[model samples]
Target: MKPWLLLGRAQPPGGGAELLLYQRDSEFSLKADNQELMNSRVYGSEEAMARLGCQNLGKRPGARVLIGGLGMGYSVRTALDTLGEDARVVVAELVPEVAEWNRGVLAELAGRPLDDRRTELHETDVAELIMAARGDYDAILLDVDNGAEAMVREGNNWLYSLPGLTAAHGALRRGGVLAVWSAVPQPAFVKRLRRAGFGVDEVKVRAHGRSSRKGGAHHVVWVAKRG
Candidate 1:
């Protein structure tokens, strides 16, 4: 049972708490625990598909979106590729080191997404971006935590709470969509969106990257429309 060692941290784009990176070596024989998702880069494979399912919606011209995380920029890159030329994407990433790692080791890990022109990385918590949006976005995608059901950080609870959902509702324009990427099905969160005055749809998308195959993690995407 090797122990996981802390590698480092860095400042993100919009300015917020730093991203934490760690590695567990069997040599030390220490278990990583429940924090496995945060400590390791799970941006590839099924998670990438789960997080990027929003792109299935045909590109909307003049569409403006806010992305809640920037793990390896897979979601951001996918969005840029799917959206029309008139679209703009603002990424709210909580850790600067994560962003830097995306540009550094993680870039080589998942291919560089920060280099994309359509993305404006904000190295800040997605909560701040949600609070300040003010009907400015056509779509809001949240990938923070493991989903609303499982939180990686204690502070992230604020983002999935009632106030946080209300804030997300206010950020969207009429007929705008608030899309959430979850690792598992959370029917309660879907109900919460309806309570917040959104027309909700719990879409189960493919977990594998660009594939519609079976036998992979289900990407439970909560699609809610404002107004």
Candidate 2:
């Protein structure tokens, strides 16, 4: 086994926790405050998030999708796989270095999904994108901060807040889906989704894959649809 090398550090906008990039052999990881934010090894739930969200979309022509986090580009790439070529994916990342990392060190790990012409990279907050667009996107996927509870950035809370849920609801077109990834179950957040006018469905997925890992750890993906 090779040792993990620290690539670089990036701070989230508004002075939140600093994200550290590490690489070991062929794998890459992003960590913050001693917590593992994302790793290249485990991305099944992320892929599932995009799959279920787009699958619920039901073949909308020229579909436009917004992905909240780039994290190894798993969600974005899986979304591209599920949606047709006409589909456009807008990825909003809070840290600029994350985009660069995706284009650089983490490029091959995610098969360079950002390089695709159908994808647009936004070096800004996802919440801003959600607030700016009204009924524009067919699907919105959030793969941020250890799930909705968030252990990385403070501002991320708004994405799972009541007002944030309302904004996400407002940002989607009729029949659009809002998908969120979390490492643990959040019953309160489920109720919040309902209050935001979304028909919610909670799916349990393993971090490694569809089944529980050796420690019985599983992740939750909330697929909420509007109208």
Candidate 3:
């Protein structure tokens, strides 16, 4: 068995726990306080989050999308592949080191999504972008924390609250979608999405790729469409 080598460490802005990066051969991992936040190997749900969110946006002219997290860059890359050439993807990442890692050692993991001409990187909180926009994005994808539970950053809780959901609802264009990634199912959050005037669909996806026989753990992705 190969050992995981520590690659880099960083502290997220606004005072949260420290983030650590590790590598084992071609695989990479981003962790916080001994808990794995994201791994390069298991990202099926992340890709699915973008796919399901933007499923209705195929070839839409001048479509705009916003991705809340840049973990391993799978969601952004998947989004870029899913949308049309005229689409624009805005990725908001709170941690500067995470963005740097995606550019450096982790670039190829998701085919260097940040380098895509359609991608615009924002080293700021996704909530700020969400609150500041009104019908600006055709789709919004959020993979910021483990789930609505907020594992890494306490400030992320607002992203799941009723107010946050309402803000997200306003940030999208008519008939736009908001897809959220979670480590576990959140039934109460589903109710909140509906309360915020969204039509919600809860999807369960395997953590690993379909080719993997083991059928890794199941993660939940909530695809909420603004009505």
By lDDT, the better pick of 2 and 3 is 3
List model 1 lDDT by residue over 1-227, tens digit each.
66667665543443434445665651111111334343232333324443444454445667788888876566777777667776778988776666766786656543565776777899787888899889998788887666785344566777777788889999988887888777778777777888888888777765554444457655577778888
lDDT by residue (163-182, candidate 2, tens digit) is 99999999999999999999
Q: After superposition, how far is residue 126 of candidate 2 from its true place, in Å?
A: 0.2
The count of residue-pair clashes in candidate 1 stands at 14
Off by over 4 Å in 2: 56-58, 210-216
Off by over 4 Å in 1: 1-34, 38-59, 210-213
Prediction 3 global C-alpha lDDT = 0.91
- For model 3, the stretches where C-alpha displacement exceeds 4 angstroms are none
lDDT of each: 0.67, 0.89, 0.91
How much is the lDDT of residue 153 in candidate 2?
82
Q: Candidate 2, clashing residue pairs? A: none
Better of 1 and 2 by TM-score: 2
TM-score of 1: 0.78
Error of 2 at 111 (Å): 1.0
Per-residue accuracy of model 3 over 1-227 as CA lDDT, tens digit each: 89999999998888887899999988888998799999988998899999999896877998999998898899999999999988999999999999998899999989999999999999999999999999999999999888876767898889999999999999999999999999999899999999999999999988885567775698999999988
